[model samples]
Target: MKINFTHKLKILHPFFYVVALCFLSTKAEEDNTDLRFATQPTHQTAVLGSTVVLPCRVIPRDGTVQWTRDGFGLGTIRRLDGFDRYSMIGSNEEGDFSLKISPVTLEDDSEYQCQVSSKKGPKLRSRVARLTVFVPPESPSISPSPEVSATAGVNVTIKCESIGGRPAPELSLRFL
Candidate 1:
């Protein structure tokens, strides 16, 4: 028995359509590979009352970039609410989404990450970057304030202490 040519064509039409769609979908996914982070924020240290920037950049430069502190969202491409010192720097056209904090404070110390949300693929997150805020210690005090007199060849003990410094301050003594 011979099948009609039109009937054969009709039956294969849907199969060809499905295969073409699958190929196109795969190509679309491959095109999205360009959407990636070009620069990831790195660990940094900032002194109190100073400014700092956490750098982040995307390759394709198409998407919304946001800053997160300790895993919580700060805002999307703008200054975060209730945080006067926090703001976004760098141009969005250039894919720079660096987070800037002016007059850094002790409370600004935390783990930060840059996040990108695009229509091409799943959300992208940069490696975690830690910010350390250094606080200067107060004036150091030494024991035997006025004077310490000792006989020749005699040993004396003196103590030095500094208060209110983060990460603890190192102490060194010099004899006059």
Candidate 2:
């Protein structure tokens, strides 16, 4: 049996089309796989009523980035709604989706992550980064009511204490 050229071409046309489609699809998948976090957010320490930035950057810039706090989504927009202090900093063109919190409060202390989702790839999440907010201690107080007198060659004990401080305040005593 001999097959004509036109018939052979017709039979192979579908196979060639399928092969090309698969190749293109694979290329697209490879490109999506390249989408990754170039810079991940790191642990941050911020003072109460201050501002802080959690850095995050993705390469290839082909995906949507969002910030999550304690596993809760904060949306993918530049500024989060209902959150006056929460916003996204850095340039979107550069793939920097850093989260910024102005006037950080004690409530802002929590774990945060940068998440990236692409059309053709699985969602990517950065390592958890903790935000620690420090609150200054109140005025320290000394026992003995401002003045204490002791006889010569006698030992006197004084106590100093500070209240309402995060991470606890270190206390040191100096004698004048």
Candidate 3:
């Protein structure tokens, strides 16, 4: 027995339509689900001893929440109103998992991870926020190019130095 195209389609159209509908609806619903907070440090540059707020917000629903520095706990006690060099501000439910650091030092320079726990599972979400302590270099002096004139092929020495700070400072040079 041979079934023509129109006849076969007539028999299978309803089932095929139902399956397509289910697949489309499920895909759309899955796309609507909240995205889990992926740890991505937004802080790129910071001066030593300056206050900085690092955000660790979570988009997906979660239960327990905690902030950690290099896997170290930041305390569960709510202390948003309290004034301190380092403080955990904002709420977990609100998805604002940010850590406030004040008067940051060289020791504070490290990666921090924000983790949220739930009945489903404990998700170790991490964000690496770096604290850079910048100390200005010492006053630079320019030796009057001897005769005040040097050929392009001639060699000239320019020196810049910074003699202070807990970590030896970094130096950069630019020829005008």
Candidate 4:
């Protein structure tokens, strides 16, 4: 028995078409897996010995999350001593990307970047967020003696001094 050429061609053509459709569908799915920032990184400030959270969010939550500091790029956290000081807080369930700094200090104050990337997409970065650390006020002191012994008609000068005070400090004096 001889197979009909046109009949064989018709079946093969449909088979080829189905295979092409499957391949194209996979490509479309891969293309759709793109990393996007639902909420860009925002500026954050913390007192020098306080904790702070920097906010970053990604949509779809189907990508690897990373945290990096100045001069680093597209990296994940590694374990070591004192790792508790810095950490990434978020999960696929919440779709949140955030950085937490505990007992933030001057070292933690710098520009930070949050990166996310899908399995088939390039790494994407959020807007740079700045971490500003404020040093609390120390015990203020008075210069030239807070208490001065003066005789009648004598001129005394009092000066108040402050160190490590945020937003500067206003010195005031009360005379009785």
In model 3, what lDDT does residue 146 have? 22
Residue-level lDDT of model 2, residues 59-108, one tens digit each, is 87877888999999999899899788999888878998899999999999
**List of clashing residue pairs for candidate 4:** none
What would the C-alpha RMSD of candidate 1 be, to one decimal place? 3.7
lDDT tens digits, residues 5-122, model 3?
9999999999999999999999877655554774345644467767777777766645556667777777654463333576766665666767778877767777766677654554
* Candidate 1 vs 4: which has more TM-score: 1
* TM-score-based ranking: 1, 2, 4, 3
- What lDDT does the true structure give each of the candidates? 0.88, 0.90, 0.65, 0.76
RMSD of 3: 9.1
Which one wins on TM-score?
1
Note the clash tally of each candidate: 0, 0, 0, 0
Clashing residue pairs in candidate 3 are: none
* Top lDDT model: 2
Q: For residues 17-66, could you state the per-residue lDDT of candidate 4 as single tens digits?
A: 99999999998887886658887777877888998888778887777777
Rank order (by lDDT, best first): 2, 1, 4, 3
Error of 1 at 60 (Å): 1.0
Total clashing pairs in model 1:
0
Q: In candidate 4, how many Å is residue 94 off?
A: 2.3
